[model samples]
Target: MTKIIDGKAVAKKVNDQTAEAVTELVAQGVQPGIAVIIVGEDPASQIYVRNKNRKALKLGMHSVVRQLPVTTTQEELLAIIAEYNADRSIHGILVQSPLPKQINEPLITRAIDPKKDVDGFHPENVGKLITNYPGHYPVANTPRGIMTMLKEYNVELAGKTAVVIGRSTIVGKPMAALLTNANATVTLAHSRTRHLKAVAKTADILVVATGITHLINGADIKPGATVIDVGMDRDENGKLTGDVDFDSAQDVAGLITPVPGGVGPMTIATLMQTTVELAKWSDAK
Candidate 1:
C-alpha cells in the first residue's frame, strides 16, 4: 500500500511544539514575534499574510501585519524593514512576494537583517544554506517544511538518488541544497531539461515543483519512490492540483503528498517554528 504523507498531522505536531516553546519563552519574558509586510492588495498575498498572522497569534506569539499601498516605493519599503531590523521585539521580518513593478524585490530582501529574515531569502542566509553552515539560521520555510515532513516520515536521504524539478529560490534551490547536505545525490531539473520524465524515473525521491499541472504521472515515477509535489495550480475546471498527477502517481510511488493537505500546511507551521527559534537565538546573544 502506498503511504500518503500526512502533512497536516506533521504540521500539527510542529505547531504543538511551537506553542509550548512560545509559552516557555513568555515565562522567560521573551515573546517570539513576526512582522509581515504585504506591498499590494493581491488577494492571494493578502490571504497568505492573514494566515501567517493568525497562526502566530494562535501559537501565543506576537504578530504584526503591515499593509502597504500598491504605490509604495522601494526606498519606503527599505525604511520599514530597517525599523523592524532594529526593533528588539520583532524576531522575524517577511516581505510578501509579487511586489509592484517599480520596486526592486532583491534589494528589499537584502535590506532585512539576516537574524530576523524569517523567509530566509537574504543572500547571507542563502549562502549559509548552500555552504551547510553550522549553528542556527532560518531557511526558506516551504522547503524547510518539506524537510521536516520527510524526517517525520523517516524517509531515508543519505546516499539516495533525489531529483528536484524546480530551480526557484523559494523551493528548488534550497531543497536541492538540503538534500545534498543530507548526503543525497540530487539532480536539479527544470522545464528545459531534455527527457525530463526519464530523469525523474531514476530517482529514489522526486520533488515536482514546476507549476504545470499534472506534469508528472505514473509512468514518470519510479516504483516505490517518494514523490513530493509543491505545485498548487488550477486545472481546466478551476480546481486545485499539483505538478504530479496524484491519481496516477500515487499508485506507483511508495509515498506521496496531497495538494491541499500536504506541503501547504507545513509551510506556515514551519514559519512559526522558525520565529520561535529566532527569538531564542536573539535572547542568547
Candidate 2:
C-alpha cells in the first residue's frame, strides 16, 4: 500500500509541540509574540495572516497584525518595521510578500532585525542557510515543514538521490540546500532543464513545486520513490490539484502528499513553531 502523508495530522503534532514550548516560555515569565505585517488587502494574504494570528493566540502567544494601505509610503512601512524590531515584546516579525511596486522588497526585507525575521528572507538567514553549517538561523517555512515531514516519515537522505523541481528562492533553493546538508545528492531542476522527466525519474526522493497543474504524473516518477507536491493550483474544471497527478502517481510512489491536506497546513504550522523558537532565542540573549 502506498503510504499517504497526512499533513493535517502532522501539522497538529507540530502545533501541539509548539503549544508545550509556549507554556514553558510563559512559565519562564515570557510570552512569545509575533507581528505579521501585510502591505495590502490581498484576499489570500489576509486569510493567511488571520490563520497565523489565530494559531499563535491559541498557543498562548501574543499575535499582532499590522494592516497597511497599498499606498503606504516606503518610509511609513520601514518606520513601522523599526517599531516592531525594537519592541522587546515582539520576537518574530513577518512582512507579507508582493509589496507594491513603489516599495523596494529587498530594502524592506533588510530593514528587519535578522533575529526577528521569521520569514527567513533576510540575506543573513539566506547566507547562513547556504553555508549548510549548523546554526540557529531561520529558514523558509514550507521547506522547513517538508524537511520535518521527511524526518517524521523516517525517510533516509544520506547517500540518497534527491531531485527538487522548481528554483524559487522561497522553497526550491532552500529545500535543495537542506537535503544536501543532510547528505543527499541534490539536483535542482528548473523550467530550462533538459530531459526534465528523465531527470525526475532518477530520484529516490522527488519534490515538485512548479505552479503548473499536473506537470508531473506517474510516468515521471521512479517506482517506490517518495513524492512531495507543493503546488496548489486549480484544474480546468476548477478543482484543486497539485503539481504531480496524485491519482496516477500514487500507484507508483512509495509515499506521497495530497494537494489540500499535504504541504499546505504544514506551512502555517511551521510559522507557529518558528515563532516560538524566535521567542526562546530572544529570551536566551
Candidate 3:
C-alpha cells in the first residue's frame, strides 16, 4: 500500500518547535521578529501576506506588514528596505513577489541585508546554499519545508536519485542544490528538456514545481518512488491542483504528497522556523 506524506502534521511539529524556540528567545530578551513588505494589491499576494502575518503572531513572534501602493517607485521601496535593514529588532525581512513592473525586482532583492533575507533570494545566501557552506543562512522556505517533510517521513536522501521539474529560483534550483548537498544525485529539469517523462521515470525521488496543472501522471513516475508536488494551480473545474495527478500517481508511487495539504502548510511553517533561526543567529553575532 502506498503511504501518503502528511505535510500538515509535519508543519505542526515544526510550528510547535518554532513556538518553543520563540518562547525561549523571549525569555532571553530576544523576540524573533519578521518584516514583510508587500508592494501591490494582487489578491494572491495579499492573502499570502495575511496568512504569514497571522501565523507569525500565533507563534508568539513579532510580525510587521508593510503594504505599499501599486504606484510606489523603486527608490521609495529601496528606502523602506534600508529602514528595516537598520532596525535591530527585525531579524527577517521579506518583500512579497510580483511587484509592479516599474520596480526592479532583482535589484530590490539585492538591496535587502543578507542576514535579513529570509526569502533566501539574495545572491549571498543562494551562494551559501549552492556551496553547502557551513553556516546558518536562511534558505527558500518552500524547498526547505519539503526537505523537512522528507526527513519527518524518514525518506532517505543519501545515494538516492532526485529529479526536480522546475528551474525557478524559488523552488527548483534551491531544491536541487539541497538534494545534492544531501548526497542525492539530482537532475534540474525544465520546460525545454527532451523526453521529459522518460527522465522523470528514472528518479527515486521526484519534485514537480512547474505550474502546469496535472503535468505528471502515473506513467511518468517510477514505481515506488517518492513524489513531491510543489505546484499550486487551478484545474479545468477551477479547483486547486498540482503538477502531478495525485490520484494516479499515488497508485503507482510508494510515497506521495497531496495537493492543498502537502507543500503549502509546510512552506509557511518553515518560514516561521527560518525567522526564529535568523533571530538566534543575530543574537549570537
Candidate 4:
C-alpha cells in the first residue's frame, strides 16, 4: 500500500507551532504583524490573501491588507510600499504576485525592506539564499514549508538521489538548492529536457512542479520513490489537480501529497511563520 503524505496534517502542525510562537511573543508584549498588499482583483490572489489574513489573525498576529485599484499608478504603489517599510509595527510585507501591467514587478519587490521582505523576493534576501549565507536564511514560503514537512516526517536526504522537475525561482530552484545542501545528489529537469522519462526514473525523491495538469503519470515515478507535487491546476470539471496524476502515480510512489490538502495549506502556514520570525528579529533591535 502506498503511504499518502498528509500535507493537511503537517500544515496543521506548522499552524499550531505558529500559534504558540504568537502567544509567546504576545506574552512578551510583542505583537507580530504582517502587511499584505494586493493590486487588482485577481480571484486566485484574492483567495490567497483572504486565507493568509484569516490564518494570521487566528494565530494572534496583526493582519493588515492594502487593496489597491487596478488603475493605481506605479508611483502610488511604491509610495504605499514605502509607508509599510517605515512602519515599525509592520514586521512582514508581501505584495501578491501578478501586479497590474503598469507596475514594474521587480521594482516593487526590490522596494520592500530586506528585513521585512518575508516573501524572500528582494535582491538581498535572494542573494543570501543563493550564497547560503550564515544565520537563518529566509526562503520562499512554499519551499520552506516543504522542507519543514520533510523534516517533520524524518525523511533522510544525505547520499540520496533527488530529482526536481521545474526551474521556477519560487519552488524548483530553491528546492534543488535545499536538497543539495543536505548532501543529496540533485538533478533539476525542466520542460526542455530531453529523455525526461529516463531522467525522472533515476531518483529516490521526485518532485513534480511542471504546472501542466497531469504532466506526470505512474511511469514517471520510480517505484517506491517519494513524490512531491507542487503544481496546482484546475481541471475542466473545476476540480483541483496537480502536475502528477495522483491516482496513477500512487501505485508506484512510496509517498505522495494530495492536491488541495497538501502543499496548498502549507504555503500560508509558512508565510505566517516567517511573519512571526520577522517580528521577533525586528523586536530584538
Candidate 5:
C-alpha cells in the first residue's frame, strides 16, 4: 500500500512553526493581525473564514472578520479595504473570493496594498509569480502549502516531471509556477487537452485541482508517482472527496494525499504562516 500523506498532521507541524514565529513577533512589540472580508453569505466561504479566525486566535494572533451585505456597493467595499490597508495593526488582508455581482473583484484586489495582499491575487503579485521572482510579491498559500508538504516529505522536484491538472489562477497556474521554480519540468493541463491520461501518466509528480471528484484514477498515474489531490468536492450525498480516486491511485502510486485530511488544512496553515512572516517583515523595518 502507498504511504498516505497525513496533511492534518503536517498542517499541525507547520502551525507549530508558525506559532513560534508569532511569539517572536509579539516579543518584538508587534502583534500579527489578519483581516478577512466576505462580501456575501457564502456558506463555504463563511466556514473557511470561521476556521481561519479560530486558528489565528489559537496561535495568539489577532483575527478580524468583516461581513458585508449582498447588496453592498463596490465603493463601500473599497472603503472598508482602505481602512484595513491604512490600519497599522492589520498586517495581512484577504477579501474572500466571489464578491457579489455588483462588485468588481479585480479592482478591489488591486486596491489592497501590495505588502498586505496575503492571498497573492493582486496584479503586482501575479506579475512577480510569472517572472519567477517570489520576493516581488506575496506567494499564494495553496501553492506554498503544497511546496511545504513536499519539503517536509523530502521529495526532490529538481528535473522531475510535474503535471498540474487545472488552469485556474488561484491553484493551477500558481502551482505550475511554484513547481517550475523548484526546477521541475511542469505541464499545465486542462479539459481541452488531447490524450489527457497519456500526458498525465508521464509525470513523476501529479497534482489534480480540477475540482471534479474521482476524475483521475490509476490508469492516469505512473507507478511510484507522487500524487497531490487539491480538490474538495461533495458527492450527491454531500460527502467530501477529491479529484483523484484515492483507492485506485494508492494501489499504483508510491504516495498520495487524501481528500479531507490532505490539502485543505494545509492551505489555512500556510496563510497563517504568511501572516506571521509579513508581520515579522514589518517589525524588522
Candidate 6:
C-alpha cells in the first residue's frame, strides 16, 4: 500500500509553530509584517495573494496587500518597493509573478531588501542557497515547503538518489540544491534530457514540476520510490491535475503526494513560516 504524504497535516504543524512564533514576537514588542504587492487583476495571482494575507492574519502576523494597476510603470513599482525597503515595520515583502509586460520582474526582485525578501527570489538569496550559506536565508517557498514535507515524513535523503524533473529557478533549481545539501545525489532533469524515463527510474525519490498535465505515470516511476508532484496544471477536461498521473503512479510509489492536497498547501505554509523567521532575524540584529 502506498503511504500518502499528508501535506495539509504537515502544513498545519508548521503553521502552528509559526503562530506561536508570531505570538512570541508580539510579546517582544514586535509584530511580524508581510507586505504582498500585486499588479493587474490576474485571477490566480489575486487568489494566491489573498490566501497568503488571510493566513498571515490568522497566525496573528501583520499583513498588507498593495494592488497596483496593470499599467503601473517600472519606476512606479520601484518607488513602492523602496518605500517598503525603508519601512522598518515591514519585515518581509513579496511581489507576485507574471507582472505586466512593461514591468521587469527580475529588476523588481533585485530592488527588494534582501533581509525582507520573503519570496526568496532575490539574487542574494538564490546565491546563498546555491552556496549552502552557513547562516539563515529565505528559500523559494514551494521548494522550501517541499523540503519541510520531506522532513516531516522522515523521507531519507543522505546517500539516496533524487531526481528533480524541471529546472525552473523557482522550484526545480532550488529543490535540487536543497536535496543535494541534504546529501542526496541529485539529478536535475528537464525537457531536453535524453532517456528521461531511465534517469527517472534511477531515483529513489522523484519530483515532477514541469507544468505539464500527467507528464509522468507509473512506468516512469521506480517501484517503491517517493514521488512529489509540484505541478498544478489543468487537463483537457478543465480539471486540476499534476504533472504525474496520480492514479497510476500512486500504485507504484511507496509514498506519494496527491495533486491538490500535496505540495500546494506547503508553499503558503512555508511563506508564512519564513516570514516569522525573517522578522526574528531582523529584530535580533
- In terms of lDDT, the best-performing candidate is 3
The lowest-lDDT stretch of 10 consecutive residues in candidate 3 is 276-285
lDDT of each model, Cα atoms only?
0.95, 0.93, 0.96, 0.88, 0.90, 0.94
Deviation of model 1 at 219, angstroms: 0.6
Off by over 4 Å in 1: 283-285
What residue pairs clash in candidate 5, if any at all? none
Could you tell me how far off, in angstroms, the CA of residue 157 lies in candidate 1 after the best superposition?
Answer: 0.6
List model 3 lDDT by residue over 13-52, tens digit each: 9999999999999999999999999998999999999999
The residue-by-residue lDDT of candidate 2 on 1-285, one tens digit each, is 789999999999999999999999999988999999999888978998898899899989999999999999999999999999999899999999889888999999999999999988898898899897476878989999999999999999999999999998789999999999899999999999999999999999999999989899999999999999999999999988999999999999999999999999999999989989998988443
Among all windows of ten consecutive residues in candidate 2, which has the lowest summed lDDT? 276-285
Sort all candidates by lDDT, best to worst.
Answer: 3, 1, 6, 2, 5, 4
- Candidate 4: RMSD over Cα atoms? 1.2
- Candidate 6 ranges beyond 4 A from true positions: none
lDDT of 6 by residue, 111-203 (tens): 999999998989999999999999998999999999999998899999999999999989999999999999999999999999998999999
**lDDT score at residue 58, model 1, on the 0-100 scale:** 94
Candidate 1 residue 176 C-alpha distance from true site, Å: 0.3
The TM-scores, one per candidate, come to: 0.99, 0.97, 0.99, 0.97, 0.97, 0.98
Model 2: runs farther than 4 Å from truth?
283-285
- Give the Cα error of residue 24 in candidate 3, in Å: 0.2
Taking all chains together, the TM-score of candidate 1 against the true structure is 0.99
Clashes of 2: 0
For candidate 6, list the clashing residue pairs, or say none: none
